[model samples]
Target: MHDTSLYSSILGLSSQWHIANAVLDSKARSLRLDIAARSCAEFCCPVCGGAAVRVGADKGCWQHEDLLNMRFHISAVIPVTLCKTCGTNRISVPWERAGSCFRCMDNP
Candidate 1:
């Protein structure tokens, strides 16, 4: 397994998620990971907690604490799901909180 695979586990991502790429900018002192959901993955309605189908996706970037003195960032393709009851909503990533641009390491 490559080091990027280790990031998936470290980030608490499930099998449904995949790390598409990883970039390290030594000069910039930043580490970025690009993540996406598996094609067969399904999401729940953020509002109603019901099954939803992916309608679209948007690019999102989030900042995380520095790793080994390098700035860490997470760039993802965020899926937008269409729920019968709630219309369309952006699915939350496992490492982030709803409506937040930062990662949550512990329950708050």
Candidate 2:
């Protein structure tokens, strides 16, 4: 997990999410972090709060505050969950609000 935990903590992530991989493009001046859910983790339906199983994932990218004067991008495999009662739903990422593609930044 080498330095990944550091990035996770910087990103304000919890146990459910972790940094799977990362790339720093100094030439392009950007940092991209790939995020994934814990494999053995169980998810609940956002609508019904019932137990849900991961069916698949959707690739998504969102811009975060710049890091070291370079663009910071958070890329994640957003989980698609199957709930018996609610059918299918896309689980929300901790960094972003539902249906948005931008990470929420702290106000100071």
- Provide the TM-score for each candidate, comma-separated: 0.79, 0.76
Backbone clashes for every candidate come to 0, 0
Q: Rate the local accuracy (lDDT) of all candidates.
A: 0.79, 0.78
- Badly placed stretches (over 4 Å) of model 1 are 98-108
lDDT of 1 at 53: 90
lDDT by residue (tens digit), candidate 2, 1-108: 247776777666879887988888889998888898888777899789999999988777778566557788887877899999999998877767555435533222
Runs in model 2 deviating more than 4 A are 65-68, 98-108
lDDT of 1 by residue, 1-55 (tens): 2477667766778887898888888899988888998888888887899989999
Q: In candidate 2, what residue range of length 10 has the lowest lDDT sum? A: 99-108
In terms of lDDT, the poorest run of 10 residues in model 1 is 99-108
